[model samples]
Target: MAFTLPFFSAKTLLTTTTTITQFPENPKTLILEQCKTIKDLNQIHAHVIKTGLLVNPTIAENLLESSAILLPGSMDYALAIFRSIDEPNPAAYNILIRGFTLKQSPREAVLLFKEMRENSVEPDKYTFPCILKACSRLQALKEGEEIHAQIVKFGFGTHGFVENTLIHMYANCGKVEVARRVFDDMSKRGVITWNSMFAGYTKSGNWDEVVKLFHKMQESGVVFDEVTMICVLTACGRLGDLELGEWINEYIDMNGLKGNLNLITSLVDMYAKCGRLDTARRLFDEMPRRDVVAWSAMISGCSQSGQCREALALFHEMQKVKVDPNEITMVSVLSACAVLGALETGKWVHFFIKKKKMKLTVTLGTALMDFYAKCGSIENSLEVFEQMPLKNVLSWTVLIQGLASNGEGRKALEFFSLMRGKNIEPNDVTFIGVLSACSHTGLVDDGRNFFVSMTIEFGIEPRIEHYGCMVDILGRAGMIEEAYQFIKNMPIKPNAIIWRTLLASCRVHKNIEIAEESLQHLVRLEPTHSGDYILLSNTYASLGRWEDALRVRSQMKEKGIKKTPGCSLIELDGVIHEFFAEDNSHPHLKEIYNATENMMKRIKSAGYVPNTAEARLDAEEDDKEASVSHHSEKLAIAFGLIRTSPGITIRISKNLRVCTDCHTATKMISKVFNREIVVRDRNRFHHFKEGSCSCNDFW
Candidate 1:
C-alpha cells in the first residue's frame, strides 16, 4: 500500500506560491456585475482607471493579471495594461504564464517568458515551473534547455518545484535520459517527483522501464499515486504479467484505492488483457458507472480471447445503458461481428458511424474492412478501403490480407505492388499477406522471389509466418521434396505450422513417405496436438491406407486425444446460428434436415459422389457416407439456403478444414441450386460457383 494521487493532471503541477489578490467589494462585486463579455471588461478597465484605483506599478500589475484571468480571450488588453506598468514583478509574469499555459495557449505563454527576460525581470522558482510546462506543452525542447540554464543561473537549481517541472518537460519532449538524470540528482524525492519520471517513461513508450522504476519506487519506499499505478498496470498488461496484475489488484484493495475510477479502469484493462475475463467483468460490473474506455477494454478483450458472443453481448448491454461508444468500441464490436459473421449487425455499426459523422480513422476503417471481408462481402471491404481518407501501414496490411483471405489472391498482390509504388514500406505483416497471396494462387515463382526480396529489397528479415508461407507455396504447387528441403534448411527452426503445411501438401499430392516423415516431426514438436494426427490420418484415408489411418487414430486414443468437433456458423438477420456435425439441438431440426436431404438429392443428380474415402471413421461404407452427408458445414449451408431467398449467396464459417466430400458436394450443390456458396474454413476461403471453386480444385 502506498500514497495515492487519487487524480492527476498537468494543471496539478502548475500550482504557485503566489495567490491572486482578493478584492473587497471592488471590481468583482461592485462594478463587474454586467461584465459578461470582453467589451464590458474593457469598460470596467477604463472605469477602474478613472476611479484612481490603479495608483502605482503594484496595483497596475495586479489589475493586468486579474483582467487576463477574467477574460481569457482578452490577451491583447492584458498586454496593453502590463506595458502601462513601469515594472512588472516576477509574480506578475508567473501568474500570466500559468494562466495562458493551463488554458491551452502554450505558445503565447512561452512568448511572454521571452518578453519578461527582455525587460530584465529574472524568473524565480515559481516562474521556472510554469514556463517549463509551457515548453513541455509545445514540445519545445531547445527552449526548455535554454530555460534550464536560466534555472541554474537564477540560483533555483536545487528547488524541487523547478526540478520536477524540468523532469516533466524532458519526459514530455521524449528526453527520458535527461529526465532520469534530473530525477536521480534530486536529493529530496517525493511521490510527485517519482510520478513525474514515471509519466515521462510511459509517454515515451518505455514500458519495461516503467515496471523497473516501480520496483525501484517500492525499494525507495516513496508513497506512489494512482498515476504511478496506471503506468505499472499498462506495462503489466503489455507484458502479460498476470501475477503482477493480480498483486496490483490486491495492493489497491489493501491501500483503500478502490474508489478511484481511473485506477479501477486501469485494473480492468490489465486483468482483461492478461486473459482474466471473469475477474475483469466482475470488476467492471461492480463499478457504479462506466465510461466508453472501460467498456471498450472489456469488449476488445473478449474479441481478442475468441469470446465473440460475449463481446457482442457486452456491446448490446453498453448500448442499452446509453454510454455512447467511440471508435475503439466500434472497432472491437466490428471484430466480434466479423468472427461470428454477423453481417447485419456490422452494417448497422457502419451506419451508426456514418450517422454520427465520425471520421473514418485508419484503425476503424481497417476493422470495418476486415469485418466485411470475413463476412464474405469483399466488395464492401474494398469500398471501405477506398473511402478511407488516411491510410497507414496497418491500413494497407488489413486490405491486402482481407483480399487474400477472400480468395482474391491476384488482387492482393496487385495492391501490394501499389502499396510499394506509393512508397509505403511493407512491414513484416504486409509480406505475410503478400506471400500468402502467392501461395493460394499457386504463384510459385512469384512466391519464391517475394520471399527472397523480403530480405533483399525490403530488408524485412523473414519471420516464421513468412517461412510457413514459402513451405505452403511449394507444398501446394506439388513440390513436396522442395518443401521438405526448405524446412530442413530454414535458418530459424521450423515451427509446428511449417511441418503441418508440408504434411497437408503431402496429403494432397499423395506423397505418403514425406507425409509420414512430417507427422513424425510433428509428433516430437506437438505430441498432444490433435491437428497433426488428424491430418496424417486423413492423408492415409485419402490414399486407401485405412490400416495406417486406424493406427494413427489408436495412437490418439492412447494419448487421450480427440479430434476437435467440426462446427459451422451461419448468420441470418444479424443472429449467428451454430451447427455441429449431426447436430440435433436446433429448434428447427426437422426443417433443416429436410432441407439438407433435398439439397443432397439434387446435388447427387448433378453428379456429386459420396467421397467417403475422406471419412475418418473405420466403419462400413454406408455409415461413412451417412456421416459425411451431414457434416456441420452442409447443415449450416442447408439452413442458409432454406431461410435465404433464392440466388443469394450463402456464407458459412467453419472451425475446421472443409472435408473433401463436403467441398465436392458444395461445388455441385452450388451449380444445381443455382447459388454461390462461400465457406471460410480453417485454412482459407472457398467460393463455390457453377461447379467450380475459386481455389480451382487446388485446395
Candidate 2:
C-alpha cells in the first residue's frame, strides 16, 4: 500500500465515492417510498429529522403530501411542516383539503380551501373534485354552485372528474334536474356519473325513471355490477311490482347471480310480501346458503298468512341447521307461537335462550312475554320478564299485558306504577297496556287518569288503540252512554275496534239503541268482516228484536259471508283437545254430550235455571237450553271434570268471548263440582272459584 499501487488505489477510491452519492441521487423518492401509512410516515419523519434533512423544502413538501394521503388526522401535522416552507404550492393545499374530505369533515375541507385561496395558493383541476365531493356529502347546493362558478372561471370545468363530481353533488342534494343539466353540458361523462343519477332516481322513489335510466345506461353499454343490480332490485321491491320483480329474477338467473345472498334475500322478501309465498319458498329453497334473515323472512310470511304451524316448523328447522337466531327471528317465532297458542313450544324457546345465554334484548324479551301471555301462561312470562336485568318501555308493556290477560289486573296496575316510580318513561304502548289492565279489572277511574296523563304529562297523542281501550274500560263499567260519547269525541276517526267496543258494551248493558248506532258505524267501516254483522245481529236478538236480527243475517248471506264458529281447547296431561260449538266430531262425543247434559241439569238444580235468553237465542225456552248445552266451553268444562280429579283446576281457552249462558254455567259448575275453573276467552280471563268470578260480573 505504501508503494502506491496506482490501479488498486483508484479502485478503492471509486467504491467510496459511489457509496456517498447514492442516497442523494433520489433522496425525495426514497423518503416517499418509506412513508406509506400513518405509522410508517411518522417513523420516516423521525428518521428525516434525525438525519438533518428536515430543512430541505422539497423533502418537507413530500413528507406533507405523504402524511395527508396516509393518515386521517395527519393533515394538521402535514400543514405544520408545510407552513415552515418559504412558499408552498397548490399541491400542498389540495392534499390537505382532500384529507379533510376523506375524514368526512367536509365543512373543514371547504374552509381550508378558502384559506388556501386567501393565501394566494391557486387551486388546480385536482382541487375541484375534492371540494365538490365535500359539497355533495354536505348537500350544500349553494356552496357547490359557487364552487362550480369558480371551477368554470378557472377553466377546470372541462375536466371530467371535476364535472362528474358536480353532477353527483346536485343529484345527491335532490336537484336531479340540475344534475341532469350539468351531465348534458359535460362533453364526456363517466360511468360514475351515470351511477350517481341512477341512485338518485331510485332514492327519490321514482321507480319508472330509475328503470328508464337503467335502460339508457345499458344502451350506452355500461356494464352492470352488484351495486347497480341491488339498486334496481330495491326499487322494484318497493314498488311491489311483481311483474317487474319477476323480470329482475330472470335477469339475475340469466346473469348467473344465484350465489348473491343479498339479491336472494331481497327477492324472497319481495315475493313473500307481495302475496306470492310459493314463489318465495321456491327461491328460498334454491339458495345454497340460508342465513337467519332468509329463515326469518319465510317464518314471517307464514305468520302473516295465518299458517302458524308452518311458521313454527320452519323456526325449528332453522335452529336445527344451527343458524344463529337474532332478535327478528325470535319475534317471528314468538308471533307464530302466540297465534297457535303453543305454550309448551314457547316455553322451550325461552329455555333455549337461557341455555344459550343469548342476550336478553328488549325486543326479544317483549316478544317472548307476549307469546306466553297470549298462550295463557302468564306466570312463565312474568318469570322471564323478572329475570331480565334491563327493562325498556316494551318490557313493561308486555308484562302489563300478561298480567291483564291472566286476570291479575290489579298487579298490572301495580307494575305500571312501579315502572313510573323507577323513572322509566312510558310510551304509547305502555299506556295501552295500562289501559287494557284497567278495562279488564273494571277500573274506570284508573283508566281515565292514564288517558289524561298520556296527553297532559307525557305529550303522547292518543292513537285509536288508546281510544278503543278507553271505550272498553267505560263500557265494561256499565258507562255505555259515556263510552258512546267518548267515541264521538275522538280526534281521529273511530276505527272498527273503537265502535265495536261500544257495541259490545251496549249488548252487555242492554242498551239496544246505542248498540244499533255503533253497529251502523262498524258495518260502514268493516263491511267485509262477517263477524261484525253477526255481532250486530246478536245484539238485536239480545233485545228481542228478532226481525232486526233476521235482517242483519240476510245481509250477511247476500254478501256471501259466514261467521267463524266458536271453538274451545283444553290442555290435559300435556295433550290438547279441541271442541267446537255444534260440532260432534270427537271420538268421545257421546260421553262428552251425556256428561254436558247431566251437568246442565245439576247446574240448574243449583239455581242456574238455564238462562238461554241471555244468549240471545231465537228459539223456544226448551230449545234454547238444549242448544246452549252444546256450547264449546260447556263441552270443554264437562270433559275436563270427567277426566281430572275433583279438586284439580280445569283450564280452558275459548276462541270467542264467553257467552252469557257459558259464564253462568261455569259459575254453577264450579260450585257444584267444588273445583276451580279458569276460562281464558278472546278478551280477558275468568277465574271461576267457589261460585264466584274474578271479574265480579263486571265483564
Candidate 3:
C-alpha cells in the first residue's frame, strides 16, 4: 500500500559504480541503489556506517527490504535490522512479515505484525493479506478475526487481496460458511476468487458444493484456470460422476486448455475412479511423459475395478522406467495383493517399504494388516498393528476384523477391549467386527449384549451390515429358529445377504423347512445366484432328501441356471496357479493329478472318508468318491504338494466356500504329511494343523 516495486532494472544497476568504499554525492540514496547481492548490500552498509553516513529512513527501509527478500533463511538477520531502525514504516513491516511467512515461519510473521501495530505503525492493505496468510497457515482463528476487525475498521474490507486472504483464513479454520459469505459478498469476483472458494470446499470435502460452485463460476463468466479444473475434477472423482467428468474433458478440449500436465493427471484420476479405465488408459498412453502421480492414478483405477494383475503390471512398468512411487501408489498395490491373496508379492511390498524406511502411516499400516490378514497370516497383521505409531479408529477396526476373520475371535474381542481401554470409541464398523467375533467364537450372550449396547448405550443405530452379522451370530451358533424369527422381525427390509445368512445356518443345522423359505425369498431377490440353489440342494442331499435335491436341480435347469464351477488358486515361486474342479489345464497337470491320487490314498489311510452326501449329482459310491477327489481345492492342494518342498506350509485361496470333503481331507493330509495348510475361502480362513481346523468344523 505504501510502497511500489519500482521496476529494478539490470541496465540501471550495471551502469552504476561498483567499488564498496567509494563515495557518492548522497550515500543514503546510494545505499541499496548500488547493491546487487545481499552480500554486496552488507558490505556497502558496513562501509557507510564506518564512514558515519546517517542511516536515513529511506536507507533504513532499503536495508530492511534487502535483508528480508534478498536471500532465504535470513529472517532472523532481517529482524535485527528492523530493530535497528529508529522508526520502521508500514513498508518495512510488510516486507519483513511477508518474508517470514514465505520462509516457513508464519508464527513469526504474525508476531512481527503485532509489534508493528504496538509501535503505532498503522497497517496498509499489503500488511493484512500477508499476516492473514500467516494466520491461515497457523489456523489462528482469533488472530484472523482480530485482523478482519482491523481490516473493516480501516475501510479495506472490500480490497480484493485483503478479502481473499480473509476468506482463506476462515476456510482453513473449518469455517466454510464464513468463507462462503465472504465469497458471495465479493462485488466483482476474479478467477483467483472463484478458485479460492473452490479450494476451500474441496478441502472441507463438500464435493457437491464444489460442483455447485463450478456451475456458479461458469454462470458468472469468470474464466477459470488449471487450478479450478483440478478442483472440479477432484470432486468428480470422489463422487464418481462420470458424465460430469466427461463433460469437463470435452470443455477442456473445446477450449484447447491442455497446457498443464497436472490437469491431464486429474483427468486420468477422474476417469479411473469413474470406472472408465479404457479412456483413462488411452489418455495415459497419449501423455508424452508419465510422472508418479499419473502412474498412481492408472494403477489405483485398475485395482479398484478388480484388474489387480494389471495394476501390478503397471507398477512393475513404473519400476522399470525408474519413476519412484509415493504412498498412494503403494496403497493401491497392497489392495491388489490383498484381493488376489498374493502373499509373497505382499511380503515383497513390505520388504520394499522397509528398505526404503517409509513411515508406517495409519493408512499404510492398515493396508498392510489387511493384506496379511487376507493372505491367512493374522500374526503378521497383529505385528503390523503393533508397529504403527499412530492408530486411528480405522486402524484398530481393521485389526479387530482381521482377527475375527482369521478365527481368532476371542483375541479379536480382547483387542476390542484394549482399543476401548485406550479411550478410542468404537463406531458402527467396530461393532460389525465385534459381532462377527461372537459369531465365530460362539459367544451368543456377548453378541446379544453388545448388539443391544451398540444401539442403546453407544447410540450407534444398527446398519444393515450390523443386523446381518447379528443374524450370523445366532445362525452360526445353531439357533436356527431364532435367526429365522429375527429376520422376520427386522425393522429394515432383509437384504439377500441376510436371507442367505439364515439359509446357510439352516443348512448347518439341517433346518430344511427354513432353507426352503429362504430360497423362496431369494428367488424374488437375486434369482440368478447359482450359489443359493447349490446351497439348498446340498442341504437336501445332506439330509438324504434325494428326490427334493433332484427336483431343485431340475428347476435350476428349467430356469437356465448353471452351477458356478468351484475355483481355487495356489501361489508358489511368485506365480499364481489357478484350478477348476477336474481342471487339467496347468502345465504340470499330470504331476498334480498323480499327487492328488497319492494324497487321497494317504489321507484315506489316515482315517479320512469321502463325504459324498453333498455331491451335486447322486452317483455310485465309487463315482462319488472320484467326484469329490477332483474338486478345485483338491487340485490346488495337489499342485502345492507336488511343487513345494516337504514340511513347508502350503496356502491356498478359494473363490467359494471349501466344501465338506476337501475340508476333511485337508485336515488329514496336514497331519499325515506333518505340514500346516491354510485355506482362505470367501468368508473366513481355515488353518489345518495336526488333524484339526481353526474353525472346529463350525464353518
> Each model's C-alpha lDDT?
0.85, 0.78, 0.86
Runs with alpha carbons beyond 4 Å of true place in candidate 3: 1-19, 23-124, 135-156, 613-623
- Give the residue spans of candidate 2 off by over 4 A: 1-248, 288-293, 316-327, 527-561, 569-578, 584-607, 611-626, 636-653, 670-678
Best by lDDT: 3
After superposing candidate 1 on the true structure, give the runs of residues whose Cα lies further than 4 Å from its correct spot. 1-36, 45-182, 203-206, 456-459, 541-560, 616-619
Q: For model 3, which pairs clash?
A: none
Write model 3 residue lDDT over 613-655, tens digit each, in one string.
6454544666877888999988888888888899988999998
Give one digit per residue, the lDDT tens place, for model 1 in 1-699.
111111212233212232324333344332223334555455445645765776655556556555666655766777787776667788788878887887788999999999999989888889999999999999999999999998888889899989999999999998999999999999999999999998898889898898899999999998878888888998888788888788888999998989988989999889888888898899999998899989998998898888999999999999999999999999999999998888889999999999999889998999999999888888999999999999999989988998887789999999998998899998999999999899888899999999999899878899899999999999999999999999999999998889999998988999999999998898899888887887888889888888998889889888888778889999898788999988899999999999999988888887788977655454576687777888899999999998999999899999888887898999898899899999988888889999889877766
TM-score of each: 0.84, 0.63, 0.88
Clashes in candidate 3: how many?
A: 0
The RMSD of every model to the true structure, in order and in angstroms, is 7.5, 9.9, 4.7
What TM-score does candidate 1 reach? 0.84
Which of 2 and 3 is the better model by lDDT? 3
| Candidate 2 backbone clash number | 0
